[model samples]
Target: MKKLPLKIVLLFTVLFASSNLFAQDFQGKAYYVSKTTMDMDEWGGRDMSPERKKQMMERMKSFLEKEYVLTFSQVESIYKEDEKLEAPGAGRGFRMGGSMTGGPKYKNVKTKEVIQDQEFFGKQFLIKDELKTIEWKMGTETKLIGQYTAFKATATVPVDRFDWRSMRRSNSDDEKKEKKKADKDSVKSTNTDITKSDDPLSEIEVPKTIDVVAWYTPQIPVNQGPDNYWGLPGLILEVNADRTTILCTKIVLNPSDKETIEQPKKGEVVTQAEYTEIITKKMQEMREMYGGRNRGRRGH
Candidate 1:
């Protein structure tokens, strides 16, 4: 029988311990506070009287401030808003403009899959599709967001033209009628012009891109962030997208109790493109129905 030398035994013991420590998964929970400042003038709030504007601002305060929790493991994360009672008159008829926040979003970096639960006009849809990739251009700029020193990165993401709110706002009756007449004229002219191959409706233009700036901390060393933001070299502590800003207020790492990160299964499963089409078609139908009712009232 033979025994290993003292040096070899100690080396093996150290390597075994290091392997176990590295193998243990790291989990973290991040608390984020989101605040949106409303541009009263942009949304027609400026047209109201002083007292009416004040009332509107006060009423919208609760809806603008939101809280979200992001629970993340090494390769998976789930981001969801903290449940709270809806504000009074929240379910009333549609407002002109509102926030762009979606619903519970789940991402798996390992599998490169994203599952987003979205609700539109009382219908639930599970947007199950590949994660949207961002070609982030990292900058040399650095800033401190809370306790973490973060680096800056910027990217341009395409805005979905089929967004219900944007579509509804843009598709007024006058615009619809004008577009229909123009479309008909173009179709008749196309017979004379053999070069015309594109559909007039498909040529309609909308704002295509949104600018996103993110501040991430290498100290955390995890590629996870609020909403659909990811792919940074570190954890994103702050994000500024258009008018919205999401800041991380607190982070808890490797807690004693672990929570499960389960993918949401309840909803009509659809791809992002399909979901966009469904919403677009539904909103068009609603507009037509409402327009018909208004015309009937006018006739009476």
Candidate 2:
């Protein structure tokens, strides 16, 4: 037989090494310290006016709950090596009259004012995330979390803290106007209004720090987790990604009734099948009471 070329021999050596790489047969819990960022750009466009930013910020705060989920997956070259895995990102959008806002009564919810398109995988989440890179590590240890034997690991993600304030008109516009008139009269009578040194928006409360901690396991290797958190060595167990938290509800390994875990892609921002009722129901009620066709009209 002719001598095998060195290059081909090296290639075979690498292949052999890869084949010999141990198949991980362990599981563990991943934990995260969760947080939330309310950004104007969560709506996709930017350069908003101060008032608009405030309004969107307030809306975002009222809309997004401070909790989310994380997932893990097993690793195999055949499954994860060549696939163009998409890192989970977050984006915001709306139902365009699909929810209560989509109904005939709230047709005037500004057409696209409500953010209905924020996906757990739509934007890269950060909290003081100046490094802009996901720091990761993986290890071996027999640990258990939610019925899975998890390995221990650690990672640090930097992020930016974001919050918002705004004024949204409600059916009580007239009442508010009367209140404002009363306030002005009181201030004029007191004459101290001219000397009052408080900022007009002193009541606005915006947080300034967001730090997150994450843990992941490769046992499930799905490259997914609760909203806007991903790209870990394994399924993240607990995440302190921001102001919100996404905890693993349950974990299963080779169950007698194994079922494919499919994430829903139809709901609006931060909304999964699990959380649809709390938010969607309230939205419907708000539309019925405040924006009813005959109730009243308000301004932004």
Which one is best on TM-score? 1
Could you give me the TM-score of model 1 versus the true structure? Answer: 0.75
- On a 0 to 100 scale, what is the lDDT of residue 155 in model 2? 60
lDDT of 1: 0.72
Error of 2 at 85 (Å): 34
lDDT of 1 by residue, 72-93 (tens): 9769999999868886876344
Instruction: Provide the TM-score for each candidate, comma-separated.
Output: 0.75, 0.32
lDDT of 2 by residue, 158-210 (tens): 33211221121222566557556655554445332321112232222334434
Model 2 lDDT, residue 299, Cα: 15
Candidate 1's error at 1, in angstroms? 56
Clashing pairs in 1: none
Question: Where's the lowest-lDDT run of ten residues in candidate 1?
Answer: 192-201
Off by over 4 Å in 1: 1-24, 85-101, 162-206
